[model samples]
Target: MEFKNGKITKGFAFLDTYELTVLMKAKKTSKAMKNTMEETQGYLGMWVTEDGYIRHELLPNNRYDEDRGKRESAYQGRYKVTGNHIEYIDDTGFTADGDFVDEKTLHHGGYIFHKKLE
Candidate 1:
């Protein structure tokens, strides 16, 4: 897959039987990293998961208030590759202590990524 000018082009022959390998290689490239940073910063963050169940923390951020003096809030979630979309769950109340402090279910859609199978 190749992303250029805000478009993602798929069907690279080299990626047919090496999708994950190629994707990881692209991910490690400077251009991909820069794009990843830009896209992720444009949103709260991004996450990637395997087997549609396991979760991986990609980026994390905290929201703070200075005027009303409210406690800091966190934005955290996971992504699962489901069919053609990377289903996401966000605002999961992820804490630095590895615990979810919020009482909410903490499951909401985040970002979507297409899964490339080898």
Candidate 2:
């Protein structure tokens, strides 16, 4: 019985060590993701269609405000950009995504938006 108890204790220790290692790895991965997002800041700015009907403002805080057909802030959302691809989760729970075709162009929801020059 004493031998069995010793094995159980060793097993618990192994599990604890494994959990700690996993947590450390997770923290490292999170930092890497944050850095990647920060590097994407160059893409931040206003993007609008040629006709000036739809506008999307990509803010530095990782949130977006969209205007449509003179409607101010038609939609508001949080966004994540990964390697020229973007995912959005709006305040109303609607989700959408887009791709950056280039430094000045974004293609989303069948609409092509150009970066509005300041």
Candidate 3:
């Protein structure tokens, strides 16, 4: 995505929810992994600044019938621009009061959504 003059132009990329969880568990730095989880959730709402890193928030799921009251109020994570694709990482797991369901069923896995902020 392109951000110029404080506006997003190219939109955001939503990562697969199950893929995200696995990625978080593979981080070499415990702190980086934590930051990744937090960034994912923060991106769902606005942006978050932790450890001097700036992260943009991604769009949330709009499947009203399925996500009506299940959507989170915020997102965490920072997007790293790599060529044409954006890499995402959850800074830290869900925050306090964050609505993250147990991954027992297929629908309970976490999902990432993205949109351009132009």
The most accurate candidate by lDDT is: 2
The C-alpha local distance difference test score for the whole of candidate 2 amounts to 0.85
Error of 2 at 39 (Å): 3.1
**Candidate 3 on 1-87: residue-level lDDT in tens?**
899999887887898999888877776467553443335443234322232132334445411111223354334444433222334
RMSD of candidate 2 to the truth, in angstroms, is 8.8
Segments of candidate 1 deviating more than 4 angstroms = 1-74, 91-118
Model 3 compared with the native: what TM-score?
Answer: 0.22
Q: What do the candidate models score in CA lDDT, each in turn?
A: 0.35, 0.85, 0.37
Residue 97 lDDT, candidate 3, scale 0-100 = 21
> Which residue segments of model 2 deviate by more than 4 Å?
1-40
Tens digit of per-residue lDDT, candidate 2, span 36-87: 4236565699999999999999998989999999799999999999877899
User: What stretches of model 3 exceed 4 Å from their correct place?
Assistant: 1-69, 93-118
Q: TM-score for every candidate vs. truth? A: 0.18, 0.66, 0.22
State residue 7's C-alpha deviation in candidate 1, in Å. 58
Q: Write the per-residue lDDT of candidate 1 for residues 47-103, one digit (tens) a residue.
A: 222333423333333331111113222344454332222334555543222211122
